[model samples]
Target: MTKDHVNYVYDPVVLKGRNTEHPVHPLILSRSSPREMSGEDIPDRELMALFDAARWAPSYRNAQPWRFLYAKRSTVHWQKFLDIVKPANQAWCHTASALVVVVAHKWTVDRETGKPKEIPTASFDTGAACMALALEGSGRDLVVHCMFGMDFEKAYKVFGIDRDRDGVQCMIAVGKRPALTVRDREPRVSQRNPIESFAFEGGFVKVYHK
Candidate 1:
């Protein structure tokens, strides 16, 4: 099929703002990690902006332990990035606009106490940064999909990563949202569990049932 015909198959969905006070909508709730992606290129500046948003995330002891190694979708470097993923993920991730290798350093010294500190909290800090990146991507009409299907040992060797001192947390596929058909993308709408099901009142004393 021609490019035009392919484009016709997936039309973009226009979303409008919803009332924020009416509990988080299902769209926010139903946001799932996208597996399949299209080969749409995202601007380098925009990617940088997303990382800037992640930079503002709070960290334990102010130790910002997250680091990202990224490559644009069509570059030669992208091939190296793709090689690290498992075969199953490689099939879909090959079409992503960008692949980001998320890493975290495992230790940091405490500035206040002037004592040696272990970076045991690096994973939490990295997770917070990933959330920031995702929210920023959502604001920019982009989707961020995080994945763990990678050979960390091989990746460390290939990327010259010190796995003992640093950790490979996850990989993120960032790109524009695609027009999905009912058969291709089921549930067309995102859904979420009720807040009462997960939320608790006053230190988990009782379930917060509505």
Candidate 2:
């Protein structure tokens, strides 16, 4: 574990200018997506631990539809994965230790009917799994950033995905963050909107927007 992971709770870099309306876990508050990485390859053991955490995410009828396809830096598959990313993203993603494509099984086979059945909750369940993966990486002081700037169609072709049953959700860049000084940390920590702005008491309510 890095120094940030060990002292996450007390790290001035994480706690600086951040506060929640209600009390929450320190780990939740410490999580942030950093673009700058060390380009150092993560050990398979540590990397798989993130996916293991993702396995426990809740899903509709326990479908567990999420799947992660990844390529580590300096590997044969690295160029292929990188090619799928957009130029703007590639600028920063080149330093990522690993690139992962999170896919969801949009259909599941029904035992009773012995036929493919649509899974409406596939995307929602997969998102939860992605959150678990990101949180786990954050807990380990790793940069785990998700992006939508990849060619989904190209990914399907490159990965040989079944378009009829599977859908690409998003891409994830995982890596070790470069050591940071306090002066350059603020931009890395994003602020959240207050609960009242997003969470309504009972149902949806009209809210003003900029």
Candidate maximizing lDDT: 2
In candidate 2, stretches whose alpha carbon ends up further than 4 angstroms from where it belongs are 1-11, 111-114, 181-188
**lDDT (10s digit) by residue, model 2, range 32-147:** 77788889899997798889889999987787999999999989999999999999999999999999999999888776888888889999999999999988888887888999
Model 1, residue pairs in steric clash: none
Q: Which RMSD does model 2 reach against the true structure?
A: 3.5
lDDT score for residue 77 of model 1:
96
lDDT per residue, candidate 1, 1-210, as tens digits?
A: 222211111122322222233655444433445555557898887788779879899998788999999999778898899889999988878888999999998888778888767787899999999988876676665767898899888879988998777899999988866676222543344444655666777766455446
Name the candidate that leads on TM-score: 2
Task: In angstroms, give how far residue 149 of model 2 lies from its true place.
Answer: 1.1
Candidate 2 Cα deviation (angstroms), residue 56: 0.6
TM-score of each: 0.75, 0.89
TM-score of 2: 0.89
Worst 10 residues of 2 by lDDT: 2-11
